[model samples]
Target: MRTARVQDLLGLLHGWYPPDQAEEWDNVGLQVGEATAAVEKLMIALDPSAAAVAAASAAGARLLVTHHPLLFKPLRRLTPDDPVGGVIWTAVRDGVAIAAAHTNLDVAADGLNRWLAARLDLLEAVPLQPAVGHLVKLAVFVPTAHAESVADALFAGGAGQIGAYDQCSFRVAGTGTFRPGPGTAPFIGEAGRREQVEEVRLETIVPQRRLPRVLEKMLKAHPYEEVAYDLVPLANELPGVGLGRIGRLAEPVALAAFAARVKAALGCSSLRLVGVPERTVAKVAVCGGSGAGLIHEARRRGAEVLVTGDVKYHEARLAEDLGIALLDAGHFATERLAVEELAERFRAGAAERGWRLDVVVFEGDRDPFVVY
Candidate 1:
């Protein structure tokens, strides 16, 4: 079995949920420890609380993966005196690497919100707010013999991915004429000679964040010194990826009954519900953590009710005014579902990659709020 490093685990997590997908204000990715550090035991949790860090350390976990970032705001110092700083100090001192998926995990196609919708048995669920990525179309001209190599490099560098298919590209064969000028080290034609070479036009889509690296790999793999390529901005948003989810229940239920269902599904002791109890509900929208902002979107998407967390009193009133039911399940209740889900995914990925690492879900992490 292969030993896993912190970088290896980061790679798998980022492949599933790219950091660029995170919200602009969100802090994500590796929070502490070296990428080269070995990871024999891994722990997954919803929050990077001090207790979670302590539990992970006691359990001999070398890496701690959490949905929430350990450090959200800018810190001037790292010491045991400050709460956030203390967690950082503990992880580093205990040799435990920390990584967070954050908004990127929330917006992924198979992210937390989607998992919540599935848990509630929503059907035909789609993103209420689809994730917008900086998309670019890359067209590269490569010699026929080197087309495959160049395309492979582009794909490996995170290009040519669309929805479920990866390495997706269109290739067209053509003849290209180029003259090698003085001081030009040409791969085909000699100096002062014009040559017609069989070439292929390989075109694919790339996220702008990965464009620079992908282009670099493409250039290195191309046979010509001066690789010909065209990059164009795309206006289309990425599909099957977004922050919140909107879907339909198999059958319509009363708003009150649905609220009960939400509480049961999320294992919450109580939830605040807005709107009439007897209102019929079929369509639903859900966002995992502090999703009160999406209430308007849910109303616009024809959702009869919105299930989310951390809704202020005014937000509930706004939902009522918009003629939609709102269920405020605790933020921790809704997002905590991802802890076990992520751990299972890590376990499966490690198994497939032949890495001998144990993935554990932190059971001690829970809601900080309690009703008297």
Candidate 2:
């Protein structure tokens, strides 16, 4: 089996998701490593800590895929004197590659939120926010006989999608009139007399990021020299890319029982809670980290409880006043799934390339905390 290059792996990741979609300040992709390096051994961890790096080295892993970036802030220099800088130096010397998929993977369809939702057994999972940008509505006139073919081609290049449905569209049949100019060659009409043909108005939505490819595909499949089409900018919101999630439990349980179940599910030692323990809690809202900001939104949305991480003292006070049950599951606990999820993706990719990639999870990667 041939080992895959680091660049090839990066390309596969970007093909499904673009790193540019991440927050402007987020640092994703390769932190260090050779592009041409052959990757046979791999390690997955939440953070790129010294211990995690040492473990990867000991396992003979040539690549490390982490959820959080090793270098969140810009580096001043690569000198060995600096603590963080020293880690980078050691990685380069040991020939270990680093890569991260942060907010981009979090907001994508079937992304981080889906993994979280599945863990809690939330059914009918859809995007909490839809893709708003990189979207264009295409309205084109085609012959009634060929409309289906054109529509199918557009769908192949990422079009005709609204919410949960794909290949979605609206069609209306009408008479289209046009005359060919002297230099123009017409497909269905004469050069002089005005000609009318039966046409179907086919409309679908395409991503702005894929506009060029979509347009090219539409034109190639369209059977008219002058393909009449309109591109409209959409201001509609999408539930796919938004922060946090709102879902219902398999069955409503008491607030106290719900909290206990969540703690056991995440394997966390302790957390803060709001609202009466005996109240029946059904609907739940969850965000991975620092989600205290969404407390009011969750309450307004009628969620009985909001499970998140990193609640400030004042935020906890506010949550108490709101009468909404809130639980802080700790930052690392909420996001640890990201590392394991990414590892699964890498293992699948490696299998496709006929290379053996071992995705080992180090038990020592947990946060340094204890509860008495």
Candidate 3:
């Protein structure tokens, strides 16, 4: 069995969501264990609970990649004598390495935000806010015969994606000048004589974190001992990273019916609703948890109903004043939908690597709310 390294998993995750995309206050990445630790089996879940940790140990998983963190607030002690302090303590004693992808995963292009938006049937959905400072332009020169191979490698390494279509790159024909010195081996030129050869200038855009990999792929695939490449900083903004989502529905439904639809979609027993039933809901906005803070932004963007969690009394009153409907789906209920998407992602990723990954949805882990 081929064992995966913690750093390998981290590298793949960075492609999905670069660490800089995370909120500054958030703590992400490898929480415990060595980066080079051998990981054959893995357990993926929403939260790193005490029971989940125990389950991971029983399943013989050396690595656990969870969405919610086991330790959000800092811990000053690790002792089994205390009730709650021992949960983390036990995980450490069991030798399981834990990693978390929180807000960074939330704001990624194909990440939690987009996944949730699509689940709600939001057509024409795009990023609520484009990612800043994440796109870079790369220019390289390759021989005419090797241009396609080099370009393909960059695309495979997560470059050349502008909007749609893979392996997308712009090329221009040019003559390249280079000379090999004595004792130097050149793929295209003889030693000691400057030679002009037909070449193509290739250009592509890559995510900032993936620049290194893209460059490496280009170098390795290009048929030259000395590759010529330039990294140009670009002002072109990336449109696929953001916080909340706004989109149009299939058709407008009355606010009450729309709320019920959401409840059925999320399998929630109860939720707090604001605004009159007759209000039509077409334009919609949503953020998974504690999204009441974005109410004004949602209204400003012409959203008739803002579907989110954690609505306070004052927030509800303000929503009513704005004539915008507010659907207070429970925090856990809204966030729980993300788990299935996360599982699918890991399944596909692991399969591609020829590794077996099981995303176990902890049976019986549900919202702790009951109506008496």
Please list the residue runs of candidate 3 whose C-alpha ends up more than 4 Å from where it truly belongs after superposition. 1-12, 36-41, 71-85, 140-158, 172-202, 215-230, 235-239, 368-372
Candidate 1 ranges with C-alpha deviation above 4 Å: 173-179, 190-198
- Angstrom error of the Cα, residue 355, model 2: value is 4.7
Expressed as tens digits, the lDDT of each residue in 15-131 for candidate 1 is 899888898899899998899999999999988889999999999999999998987787898889899889989998999999999999999988898899999999999999986
Note the Cα lDDT for every prediction shown. Answer: 0.92, 0.79, 0.80
1 against 3, candidate with superior TM-score:
1
Winner by lDDT between candidate 3 and candidate 1: 1
Q: Lowest summed-lDDT stretch of 10 residues in model 1?
A: 127-136
What would the TM-scores of all predictions be?
A: 0.94, 0.78, 0.78
> Which residue ranges in model 2 land beyond 4 Å of their true spot?
11-21, 34-36, 71-74, 121-134, 140-153, 161-201, 216-229, 235-241, 349-355, 370-372
| Global lDDT of model 1 | 0.92
lDDT (tens digit, per residue) of candidate 3 on 1-372: 355777877777776777878888887888776789777777776777777778878888777777776666677786787544665666678877888888898888788777778878898876665557767889999889988888889988999777666666799999999889899889976999999999999998887878889888888898888888888877675667788888999999898998898899888888888998888889988888778988888888888998888899999999989988999898788878777776677667777897645545544356767766
Candidate 2 lDDT tens digits, 1-372? 877778877876665456756777888888889989987788888888777777888899887777777888988788877877777877888888888777777666656766776776665555443445656789999999999989988988888777679998899999999988887888887787698899999998876767788788889999898899999987666546656777888889998898888788777888767778899988888877667888888888878888888888889889889988888888877777777777788788778878766777755777566667
> Which residue pairs show collisions in model 1?
none
Candidate 1 scores a C-alpha RMSD against the true structure in Å of: 1.9
